[model samples]
Target chain A: MTGIVVLAVAVMAALGFGLYRRTRDGRFAADAAAGDGPTTPTTPTTPAWTAILAAHPDGELGERATLVQFSSAFCAPCRATRVVLGGIAEREAGVVHLEVDAEKHLALVRALDVRRTPTTLILDAAGRELGRAAGAPRRDQVLAALPA
Target chain B: MTGIDPRGPRFTAAVTALIVAAALVIPSANLSALLMFIQGAFFAVGAYAGVQYTPTAVLFRRVIRPRLSPPTELEDPRPPQFAQGIGLVFAVVSVTGYAIGPVLLGQVAAGLAFAAALLNAVFGFCLGCELYLRGLRLKERLA
Candidate 1:
């Protein structure tokens, strides 16, 4: 029956999306994790910041960690991200949250391969690009991702 | 740009799911056509004027939300509006598909819309919202 088919689709979609929903929110993964290369954590003295910023221009570097968040006006997650990052910046003295308008910085977005609103590019004080999280990150997740 | 109750859209999706499911399961061409029109009209109103104006939203405000405990958080309206736009496209295409030739086209479109709404209703997943973001990414990549 068509109804049976439709209901079956509903059940499958529910299961598929339920699993995706469980994992997709606020989870951070390193860029190198995409490849076979083991993720080597950025050191305090890395010289990669200048080159990274030259390639992907946005905001000034922070003192400790710079959270460069690419946000679109209409996206909902961006709002939540703004709050999360702002709170992090507030509580932590050296950290900074830089919110970029993705609409205005299409070239930068393309350059960074920012595929979603609220895609955060975590940079060290030296301006080196670190890992990125594609959704609105939770407080603990953001805190954990920051440079020690 | 106020935040919606979040549950409001879910309620709307639930209603949409039922209507679309009924339309799909029933074999009457005339009945299906009528159902599509009604559903399409709801989508159009929600798409253009925002979901706050829809009949379902009224139900949420007047009856449902009161019985329920207050939401711990509120969500932006734009993503859901984007979803309504996606719903509008499918509903229109389904109507047009039925008008032209193959009834199956209409059924498939309706089924897709129904499935998407059902996903949001039950699982709190926003497929349309996700697609909108992906489409933006694709456009950025292409340019």
Candidate 2:
């Protein structure tokens, strides 16, 4: 009786977590100073922005904002992220979509403190960090995260 | 990136959850091993050959696919199969727990795995897959 009860409770908890995860759009607000959001840390604890650019495969920043997507080879959502981000890049003249294989670029992924596949880092024209999101985001959500 | 039908894995997860949940409720010694054996085969086939060969996949391809409407989109099978590999690990541990000493340990393992399977079946998100992705990322970072 006790085992069944525990299992039931566990299932309910897992369901709760899964529901919470599914509804969350990968929207990390662009305010670091305000300090309380899903934003990846308030500031860069690593090297300069230019140096970070050098480490990534696409050495050049976008004319306005770059969509840096880190993906693994077998990640399903990475494909979806590609379609969404690539679509955004196509419509917006100034934005560019760049994808890096997380497996191949482990060091860079580590440097950026990426914890998941389909992690997108938004960078300005000067390669300055604007915002970051883990998991696939909708078209509008990505747009909202970009630096204006 | 196996561009397979996305529903197949979910179908299997649902079945796995049902059986594992039943096992938890029953707490039979034979059912314990049976659950492991069944789930183990499913995960091994999914993780190794591909998702197509897994027992539930086969059933889905035959009975379910014929009945339901076609999938609107196809998804990569790797993540769910990776999720299966995670299931296999838990199933193994649970089986070991049942065989060696405490039956409760096995029940606990099954319960944990059942929760994951249930999550995948109901929520469409595989926490096991997420954990696997995190593990891969961590391994990349640590190494």
Query: Using DockQ as the measure, which candidate wins?
Result: 2
Q: Write the per-residue lDDT of candidate 2 for residues A62-99, one digit (tens) a residue.
A: 79888888887556678889999999999997898888
Query: What's the DockQ of model 1?
Result: 0.49
Candidate 1, CAPRI quality class derived from DockQ: medium
Off by over 4 Å in 2: A31-52, B140-143
Per-prediction interface RMSD in Å? 2.4, 1.9
Clash-forming residue pairs, model 2: none
Clashes of each: 0, 0
Please give the distance, in angstroms, between residue B77's alpha carbon in candidate 1 and its true position after superposition.
2.0
Which sections of candidate 1 miss by over 4 Å? A33-58, B137-143
